[model samples]
Target chain A: MQKTFKIVDEDGIHARPATALVNTATKFKDTEVFAESGGKKVTLKSILGVLSLGLEPGDTLSLIAEGGQAAEALSALQEVMVKEGLGEVQE
Target chain B: MDKTALSKDILKLVGGEENIEQVTHCMTRLRFNLNDNKKADKAALQKTDGVMGVMINGGQFQVIIGNDVPVVYNELVKNMKGSPEGRVSSSSADAGDKKKKNVLSSILDFISGSFTPILPAITGAGMIKGIIALLVAAGWMGTTSSTYIILSAIGDGAFYFLPIILAVSAARKLGSNMYIAAAIGAAILHPTITTLLGAGEPVTFASLPVVAATYSSSVIPIIIAVWLASYVEKAVDKVTHASLKLIIVPTVTLLVIVPLTLIAVGPIGVIVGNGLTDGISWLFDNTGLFAGLLLGGTMSLLIITGMHYALIPIMIASIATLGYDYIIPIMMVANFAQAGATFGVFLKTKNSKLKPLALSTSVTALMGITEPAMYGVNMRFKKPFIGALIGGAVGGAFLSLFKVKAYVIGGLAGLSGIPMVIGATFVYSLIGFAIGIVVAAVATYIMGFEDEPEAAAAAVPAATADANASSSNSAVIADALEAETAPKVTEDIYSPITGEVKPLSEVNDPAFSEEIMGKGFAIQPSEGRVVSPVNGTVFSLSKSGHAIGLVSDNGAEMLIHIGIDTVKLKGLHFSPKVTAGTKVSVGDLLMEFDRVEIEKAGYSTITPVIITNIAEYSSIKPGGRSAVKEQELLYTVQA
Candidate 1:
């Protein structure tokens, strides 16, 4: 299942910030959670995926969660979003 | 995206695939000629990285890449492979555009484009003259005093040598060698020739009797000389620069050119100048108000094309023959009107980004320059320009009514001529100026502006418009999910404007307050005739009239949003039938606004129509903006 969130950061998370989120999320096993912004999704670990999002500062996104740590991984990813202070994590 | 791809994306964003015409750099802007002004996504451009702002002026798209504008311009041009002088796509073409422009629009465009670059010089000179005049009047320096003479000379230098500047500009316009053209003009204006002419003897040039006119301080002769010079240069270039022809060819050409010019070009140019002045005088006399309205309405359009330079000869001729011209004074008023209208919208709107454009344009307009404002903001919004047109017509008519005139021939049709105009026409000109400002401000206030519709349409995504409709039509749909006894009352849903109403849930977006995304309920009514749910105080309403906020006596905060993305509609479809703090009964029609227009604006009528103040109550009921009698239970929330 996927839920949407609005990107809140002014500059938006560039490649570095997107990598931080993706690399941190890949730590979870068998739980595939990916973020899609501006209607395109990127792999949780692929830096290319994040940059392809072309997510602007005010852009919105959807986070898709599935598999084993889907819920836990989603929670951890939401934490990164909260830390980076962009996008509201859906309940 | 990598940095290269990012910049590539930026170029594509400007309009990919044959939209850009020419790319030129000035100061910090990358100016492009677009085939269609409407095709490019303006909002996206504003938010794009490396773009400070976007300015549309003189039929050109100006992107402010700041100090690195040169780099961006280079990058954009390199990828473009040289933008050919090709027409834009036919699908995006404007209507009824095949006919050649009549003399008027052509004249306006000529004058505007020619003067825009030279304005700084005129303003500086005019201000110096104004200061010197003040000093002379104040007894600090006599008119013939050395201090006064030096200062006045500084002020008058450009006007004295005006022929040279006009020659260079005309030569460039004709695509000829400019310096040679300037030299020909200088020959005509030589101080020695002025002495011979002052002696009042007919000088024979190659046996054709010459008009011994002093060409110094003359404007029209250069335009004619350079036009003639262009043909001569082209002919010379065709022959040869080989065989040591460089110095010898130019020298012989000048010898042939000077005699021919004095006898042929100068006199004919003077006659053309007089004819132009006569035509203007005829227009002012014959048509009066009709002329005023037409010119005033399209003044900004002229300035936008940079064609306002064509007015120079007429102005100089008027000064030569009548000692004054009324046209420049009226034009200045219209110019100010354009700025004033933009300023009005800039002040009235809630948007933060539009304010700087308004302020800068307004300030620039006050000084009698309007391209920055005209291109930057006024034309972008549809209604503000109408306001400018209205103000311009009124101002122009009033000036004509008073017959205001300017004696001095400084910066023809520019603000610098205001003092001379005031001196010639007095209280009438000043009053006309005041009238121009007042009319512009008032028209802009009343006419208002239309914000770009796309931003409001995309405010919410597509899915919410449909799902909200499903939850709204079926009470069982509401009951099956989380049923609460909504206060039931049946009243008539009358036509707000005798037009159609649509169900909010049936619309496209999925997020209203309660239907798809939020805890609040939404309604898909048959139409958009919003009636009062209960007696309430009108709270917050946007100036645009798209969304309204209301407070019930019991403190139920409700937001009666008019349409989805209707904010972009910018008052085209919606009209607030009521002001804030208006009282209403359950069945009383609170507001009458447009519903189909909301849909046409690329938004769904699936208005969340939410009870935002539901937190104040144990539970609140939801209602519809249409199809229900007054006092119907739309929905309720329990506190």
Candidate 2:
């Protein structure tokens, strides 16, 4: 399962938002989550990996999860991204 | 570790603040002149977390701390109680060292010490003059244009007012008030005095006849005047009351030194300068080729003994009075010869470790800074030094035969300085430069020396193993063995800036010094350029354009922070070459900044390169040398 989100925060996905994304990914233990941007992908569970993407304002990020709870994991990540004002889920 | 903790640790290891009689720092090292060298623990300091290395040279204990030396030095000052200013009286402590040094070495030390600090300003002004000469010669700039007039003033100002600058440096060296010395210099060059001297009439000061010689652009007069002023200032200070010292000391010093200089010392200095110039002119005029050969062949020997600085006044005097100089051309040939020999070694050496050093030093030598090439490469292999001497002699003889002269004081003595010579023999000067390089390189290649042994390379690790054994670090030994035997996964991190690479712990910022942000290295950039070290995507960039983050294709996260606290610059003098989220391959231009302007605005250009995802790697080893070129291997991260 995958969902695309647009970053809205002025500072982009810096340390705080990166930490939030990592926490959301680790919550789904059975699922493997990765963040993809500009054709580069990194494990979403690692804060450094997610922060390294350097996602800026108006940039699109795709969250991918592979497992039985893949859809649930993507939904949780998307909710956190929007709730933290880091991004909005793409229609 | 933070500066406070690191400074405290270092102080204890060096037998506390009481042992330190004096302390100073350059870019990367903290130099401490201890009261007793034996009191300092060299072994323990080497193992300290923040210290990269420990060395003792010239009776001073030097702690290598990379870029954060100034901050650590400040912290140490705060911890010391004996001297609030972090400096104890050196007169008594230096007695032993002074007794050991002979008179010749002491004089050499004094001359070199006084001249070294002001070399940057001299070189900068000299290069500007050389460039302007080139532009005028090429006819791109007219000699009468306002642009030319302004540029000439900028280039000529340093030489015209050199006495004031020299006074400051010489005063500092002699432990006297620099401002008083500057006032003495100014008095001699004052308009009233110059007008009197220019009137073609005799001048008198306090019934004593003053010399009508000009002091502007002259070297020896100001140096001698400052030397005498130092003594007068010291003597005046001794009798002045503490309450009235501020007003009485300088007042008496200027009153005594200025009149004395105008009447007696200044004329003697001018005669000395003229004598030296005449002596050199006679040598070149009487036996041109032989004189050049002797000077060029022995220039390196003079530099090693610090006697080269003693000749600087003669060069300046020649330029000021004679309108052209022969010494600079001979010196240029010697420099090129040394560079050529170093390049030859770079090509012939089988040692991979020595090759890069030779290549870099050779390039620096060609640019007119030959100390590294001379000491690090040519002198190391005895044959190369002989080759340089032979090449220098041949090139010198050729140039002397044609009587080529440098029309301007060019900062660089290399190919770039070819424009400095601008007479009928200009083409011959160029040929002499090329011959210097060609002959030296050919000679060094044909007369090869013994190559460094492979056992010498392997002994470095053995020494580390022995240190670990002495400390009884068994776990480290086991890990080392495992790393050697195991199928290790490693990634290379290349340098993003062309400069000297230092340990990350030397960064002034605690976030970097303590390794809280990550493990990495720092660079004292020579140029204002930053490039991508990996085929990566730009992760983030600070709004101020002072910092950039990147993620490699292989998942290595790195942060390159340009300069310390440069964000305060508000993006001035800094331009982002690429925006965040852009893809950049290795060696791609990431940012451009005005390094010279940034430095003028009071900011250090030492950049830190950190691996933000250091937790994912087991070990990160920095390349064990100071000089690093862009795209060179900086670190090896083992997973």
Candidate 3:
């Protein structure tokens, strides 16, 4: 499952939010979540990897989750994004 | 995984922050000067998630962390803050080990430590000189052209002011005032001194005959001057008043040291440097290939002991006086030989960790920074170093036979220094370089090393295992797993505030007195300052500065709340030195509060130092120090 969202947080996905995102993504067993932005893709479950992407406010981010609980994981991650004021699901 | 979590784990495995006397990192490893080597669990560190390997060599406990070392280093620094004393006193650590080392090794350590920090400047300037040589050889830039002159000056600047640079680094190494050392270097290299020397006229300093020897581009004179000046500065500082020390110490030290250097030390150094140059020149002239073979075979040893720096002055002096240097060419073959051996290791090693390191280090060695290859790969494997020595010996003999010499001081003895031997025998030098590498590689291949065993490979498999593990994991899941599987370990938490110890029941607040927050003790703080109780990151700090949370290296979460209901003051009379996410060490000042003002504000300053996660620990014992001092053991928790 894949979904694109525009970063809503003013400071973008920096250390705090990146950590939160990683924490959220790692909750779903066997599902590998990856975040892609600006031609760079990184495992959303890894804080260093997500931070390395250097995602910024207004930057489009595509969240891709693989494995059995991919859709449920994406929905949970999307809900977390809204709760943490990181980003919102597009459409 | 998280860098902070990884740093904490590494710190714990290395016997926590208390065990480390000093810590520094090179390109790939975290080098630690541990107070007790036995305290460090090297086995656990090797099996760590981020750590690739661990080695105890050269009086340092080294942890290999690969490329992301700086990030990890920063995290480690954050966790530990500074050493236990809150100052980086490297000399104290060295003093303890000094007795164990022989005089030669001690001197080498001093020389190498002094030279290591300034290598980038030397290598950069050498490369620029090589580029200029190439430009001139290609007829692309005329020697008279402004561009060429500018570039040439840029390249020559480092060499010209070599004494000043060496003075600063040497002063730092010797734990003396660097500015004063620089002053001494500058005085000798001053235009007036240089002019008087260049004129070939006799100069005298207070009836003492001064030797008219070149100081610019000279290495030995300034290093010796600084070494003596370190002692002189100390002697002068002893008599000087604390208030006048800023002005009086440097002035008296400079007055006494500069003239002494000009009349005595400088001349003696020049003579020693000259004698070394002469000796080497005579050896080359008399023994021929044997001199090259001996020097080349032993160059690695010289480098390891930093005796190579002693040869630098001789090489420069030879270039200045003899028109060409024989040492640099021999050194070049030695460097290439080491690189070749490293390449051989890369080809032979099945250890995935060693393979990439070997490959990269070999490339780096070819470019002239060979310490990584020398220490990380070649020396670690043992046989490769010997293979490199054999290769160096053979190549050195070939170079000596061809009478190959470097016409200029260029980049370190590697592929980059080829333009240095741009004279008639350039082709022969190149052939010699090639021969050194090929012979070394073949020799290393023939003499195979005991490769790193499969069990020692920690990083790759651990990463995959982590990825495949249960997703419902905390930040320190690995640590949690280790704790559950491994033996129970006990950790001590020191008192953050220096004051009279009080029972938790004495606290006015029910939340703390009732042990609802967690079970621990309180302190009736006499001092205003608050320091970290453990080596860990600042987990949380309230906006009012009344409470600060800390998570220790061993995962003990603590909360130190200052005064009863002092949060109502809204940060008034309170100052926090660290914010959330700040890495702190025991004795590192965390905050300061006005005890009198808090009392006047009707708040009782009974600071509760509680282990918030007390359920995780099996037992908590008091340190029994009633008249407590900051960093004194307050509680010991067994987990």
Off by over 4 Å in 3: A1-91, B1-99, B281-287, B301-325, B335-387, B405-426, B441-639
Question: Tens digits of per-residue lDDT for model 1 on B46-80?
Answer: 55665545545434556655446556666666666
How many clashes show up in model 1?
59
Question: Residue by residue across B117-200, what tens digits does model 3's lDDT show?
Answer: 566576577667777877898899999999998998887787788889989988876778888999899999999889987798
**Top-TM-score candidate index:** 2
Interface RMSD of each: 20.2, 13.1, 14.8
Q: Model 2 over residues B196-248: C-alpha lDDT tens digits?
A: 99898988877889888788877778888888888888888898889999999
Classified by CAPRI criteria, candidate 2 counts as: incorrect
Q: What are the lDDT scores of the predictions, listed in order?
A: 0.58, 0.75, 0.75
Clashes of each: 59, 2, 1
Candidate 1 scores a chain A TM-score of 0.85
Model 2 misplacement above 4 A:
A1-91, B1-95, B131-150, B321-323, B346-364, B367-369, B407-427, B451-639
Residue A4 accuracy (lDDT) in model 2: 94
**Prediction 1 global C-alpha lDDT:** 0.58
Interface RMSD of 1: 20.2
All candidates' TM-scores? 0.47, 0.53, 0.52
Clashes of 2: 2
